[model samples]
Target: MSNISVSENEASSSEPENKNSPAVIEESPELQRASSSTVPPDVPSDEPPDAPDGGWPAWSQVVSAHIANMISWGYGTGFSVFQLYYKQTMNLPAVQVSWIGSVQIFLCFLVGVASGRLSDGGHSRQLYATGAIICIFGMFMTSLTNTYWQILLAQGFCQGIGAGLVFMPASASVAVYFKKNRSFAIAASGCGSSSGAILYPAIVQFLMPSVGFPWAVRICGFISIALAIVGFCLLKPRELHRVPAPYLDLKAFKSLPYSLFTAGSFLVYFSLFTILIYINSFAREILGLGDVKSVEFVLVTNAIAIVARPIFGFLADKFLGPVETFGLNCIALGVMAFGWIGVHERIAMYVYSAFVGFVNGGAQGLFTSAISSFVPDVRKMGTWIGMTLGLCGFATLAGPPTMGAIVDANGGKYLWAQVWAGSTIIIGGTMVLISSRLVLRDSAKPSAI
Candidate 1:
């Protein structure tokens, strides 16, 4: 919240931004053992650090970050609806329309590596502001695009990159502030993403009818501008120490358990967007549901996830180590994937959506903590977070269209798509189980809490 103007010279001169420079991710004695070497993988016995005195300010930071991240989520989700509008109004092919969404998802995660490094090196506000500007530009560009590539470049690539920039710092800043309730804070941030899925689709559906596509997109653009300002004002680093930016750490690959964890995360993340974006269309075409009902189903699923995410986080903090928690959730997620087997009627659809939302939502809560636990060097957190998410981003990039391709391959049916998604999720759970055990066994037990 401080009006700190970080100069480019200040950032660059401070430290050479590279991973092999030196060790920066400092941890408590117990944390070092739990993550670095052989240690007990149990929750620490001591209480967390006390809450800051200015309760309102602390709460504001969380609220503002949530609003900013949610807006980013809305930007991406809204773009999907925009693509649907283009297909309907401009007569774009399904395959071509698919590229717009693919590019957006890929660009969002790909650009995050740079954004994460910037945040780590004490230029969060500047980097975040720049990202927001790009987000706004992407929206404005969407209003102008008529061809598929234009939309892909503008709405997909540009918007995705911009939103990606906003997302990492906003979420990471929240992590820097609260240590004890990190899971809850992250869950709240995740809720913002879910809210975007709920509201943006409706916004597009409602506005496209009344204002038409161009103006409707403009409305979304203005919304991004407002969100950027609020986020820019609230963003700050928790501590003032200068840390080197984390380039991708190849040493992480030396740890086979870490590699498996990353791989499993990739599989789960890849199936997520594909399911979220295409489910409504599947409900309408495959199950013969109405448009309103189809949209409501998506909203309901996301709404349930909002609560599930936080609750899962709370449980992880209290009862299990991050890796164990992640593994458990993945198992539950795999079980819930079976719920989608025969969702024919309206009642069945709602039930399936609710269960899947809870399971998948909880899985994310576990995933974030798991990554943090595996990489306990808080100093280099931004880099590790970026690297892990960037890997997940690769999954997200492939997820949507792979499912779309499956749908196309199945003569436009989601039956095979659902099967493929469920299989991937189950495989993710299997990997989580094996990897968590390996991590727990290898970690060194430290003396201090």
Candidate 2:
């Protein structure tokens, strides 16, 4: 009787506790609601996270993009030497020789359109590695070419296609890792252009006589191989396959600021490459400078821009703002183009080139930075950048050749061409300025742009 009473008392105590505690959670709606997770309808779970703006991983991408910028811009910088060489040796007309350069630049930007989309789909490494190989192969094959057709296929088609592939993807990679200092990072990457410009001209000028044209080009190829290896090693893609958007983001053109900025970008490229293409020739033919001396001026132009480009970027990030800074640069480039008309004396020409280089280099460095001014979503960066630059390809293709033909038609006088370049750039600057005001007043997050 005592054991039975004890067991029944224990069961009665445990039953009440279990019924009160467990039944509260199971039967009381308020308790059940408190325990379960309930997400608000407005908040999205799949939004992209914010960038880790200043870590080793972030900075490493800048380095890789720098290497990419070096290769892409480096080869273009040395083309003047080849231009002079091909003209003298092959008996080709000046306009015909310039087609090679125009075609090369056109393909670089053209191929970038497709490759940039590929980058958005997370093919950066594959595009980069393949571009490096193809570019290096084109360089080697260029060394063996004796005819214009052969050179055009090897250098213009293959190498230009390769440059287009690598440069955009690497740049797009850098765009993802930064927010606050994006303008600075993008501009800093352009310092690669200065490095390549200096090294390429210096290499050809000093080594061509001793090593011959073939071996000098081969040496550049060797250096390219080394940089390509380093670029592939450092590059890391953070974003994976994005749900595909329209091949052409036609909706982007609906925005007033986007349209104006795109037009400004086009006009600026039209005027900008004129200086790079003809500066050496002007120094050689009009000023009576020898081969080595004229080439030295080209070096001077490239070297000063290295320091100037970064300073422009820093100012855009900290003080002036990117679009505002770009507007100023376009105006300055216009004045520089006009100023070129007055430079006849050798010493005066040297001073003028340094100044022009500073302004022009700053402008090139500002390009991607300025575009970032209006781009709100980081995910769409590769697509937007590609579209803008690819359109600018038409300008680049048409710029140098058109200017060369104008000079040729004007009996070798650069006066008319200079006027056209200056007028177009200043007009472009005005459009950009108007666009800047519209953006600052209307953007929901004005300061972020």
Candidate 3:
């Protein structure tokens, strides 16, 4: 591990003399100079700090991170296939069946603090290696389980924790490597989720009927294993200035922008997974689509995301800036939520899926890059992101089951669920707009809050 350095501009510009005043500084050339200077000492000074931005090492890391993203996020995002399968095969209530997917998402966010802290402490590779093994083991165990509890422990809890460990570190590493094109780099890595989304559902659809559930799941597990190994070899992080504190900075809430941003993230996630989890079921139960056709809804949504991610990333970098882009995308997501109410016919469903998928990909893919802009020191990024995401984890935990209860109470109609999802996302979008205003107002003096 190499020592880290903070440029004079970054060190001097990070803090405000007046505690109550917003730190707004001019967007000077110094800011750009300081950005690359924050890299660890091991990077050669002769080569442009942004060299690896397109160079093989940087792209290789992105590719590995993409693989990890595909394995972790792909499974969680496409859990609808399994959800529909459980509904038909198992004698469980909708609420009980929803727990498996909910728990998987919950642990993925909840473990962020620990995993991020570990990465900040220079344990990134170890965490990724351990996570890969745990995730592979969980998937293999899932294939062997017949009971709900067994699957919950193996697939939901075990795999979720492993995925979190892999994802957080991989995300943090990309920030370390790219400063000028950070959003685009992160977006490129994030496309793996969309790719997984495109491939996994189709794989399950083909495999489940031909080979049955156990083999279908095991085959996915095998694919995850191969990807994880390659990702583990490629993913690397720059050394930190120092190890981060074991505890989360509760004082981070004092920053108005950060507080509001976290709140908005929490609210957005409250209904975020609802569509992904239940869209296939909605098509089958509400729209009268066949099993295969219903699964295609998931495919279409994720497939559109593949193209949308890079476009949004480019827009974030070149025009809107990450915070603005994220807020605007959130608004688009809210509008698309309303579109879901009209999705009765096949054409309407596909249209809604494509629009929502585009917006959702932009919002999610740009999230980490947006947050990174708030940090003054890249060394503490892992801790800040972990704590913020950990707070949002509760929303992921509660959202699905609450929606399940609402659907059950309404006699299986999706009207109330749509209302819940749309209203929360709209509110979340408003919160993000407020945060963006704070960022814009304080743009003159850039302080990593």
Candidate 4:
């Protein structure tokens, strides 16, 4: 492992020590205590101080990170197949079916605070290994269950926790390797989810009738295990003296800009997943498409995302700053949400899915870079990011069920749900614009966030 270090004088002079700013000028005693375990005592300290950002090691880490996203988010987001299956086979209501996905997403985000802290303390590899084992176990257990509660405990809670442990560390590790090309790297990693989205739905769609549901899910589990093994082997952290930070940094919210940004993120996530969960059902129930035809909507959405995410990442890096790009993406998402209201035919729904998928992919891909602009200390990146996502976890957890309840209230009509989704996304986009303005007003460089 290679370690990077900065001199005390350089650290002090680069950024002013402001209490209100989300900047850490010096490692506190607590952080110093935590740093002890991050590095081995026998390792020589005469190496170098900056990462070889474009080297083989850095790129390998990127590849590993991409695999991690594919397994955790790609497979996780494709739960719409299971959502449809549970609705037809088990006679479950939309709300209950929504919980299975929501709980998985919720735990993935909520557990990031702890997982981020662990990564910051140099436990990245251990977290990945443990999560892989637990996730594999959870999937196998899910194959044996027939009841909702059993599925929820096995697939929802167990798998969710495992994914969280893998997700944060893999994601945060990318920052350790890149600076100038950071957005592009993050975007590339995110495409894994899009790839997974394309592959997994098609797999489930093809396999369900032939092999049955239990074996279909188990096959997905086996694929996850293989990917996790690859990720564990290649995802190495850039060795550095890590500053020990609190598991959760409540003080990050003290900055009004950060607080507003977090609130906006919460609202954005609240509506972001509504379409992904219900689009298949919408196509089948409302548009009268068959099962095979309906799953095509999901395939189109994720397939477009593969191209859109990297393009948006490049645009953000070269032209639009991350905050501006993210805000615009959210605005586009809101407008697209409204487009769903007018979609009645298969052609109309397909067009809607393509437009929304592109915009949503851009928004999600740029999210980490947009948030990273706010923090001065890169060491605390995991903790700050964890805090943002942890707060937003509640919204992700509640969004689907609330939308399901609205659909149920309207006797399966989706008009109100569309309205609800569009309105919240627009509101969230407005808050993002406000946060961007504050960032611009406070600093000469808007990218500074």
Cα lDDT tens digits for candidate 4, 304-343: 9888888987876666666667878998998888889999
lDDT of 3 by residue, 1-449 (tens): 11223456765555422224464333334233222112222122222243355677777778887887887778888888888888888967767888888888888887878898888788889888887788888888988999999989997999899888888888888877876677888888888888887777778777888998888888988888888888988886765466447648676676677778889988988888888889998998899999999998899899888888889888777666676678778878877877788887998998888888899999888877777656555677788788877877888888888888888899999888888998898898788777866744453343442
Question: Any idea what lDDT model 2 has?
Answer: 0.76
Candidate with the larger lDDT of 2 and 3 = 3
Task: Please write out the lDDT profile of model 2 over residues 133-245, one tens digit for every residue.
Answer: 98899989989999999998988788888889888889988777775576778888888877888887678778999999889889989999999999999999885448776
The per-candidate count of clashes, in order, stands at: 8, 0, 5, 1
Worst 10 residues of 3 by lDDT: 36-45
lDDT of 1 by residue, 187-237 (tens): 676777777777777766677768977887788778767777887787765
Best by lDDT: 4
Superior candidate under TM-score, 1 versus 3: 3
Give each model's whole-structure lDDT.
Answer: 0.67, 0.76, 0.77, 0.78
State candidate 4's TM-score: 0.88
Kindly indicate the candidate among 3 and 4 with the higher TM-score.
Answer: 3
Question: How do these models rank on TM-score, best leading?
Answer: 3, 4, 2, 1
The CA lDDT at 263 in model 2 is 95
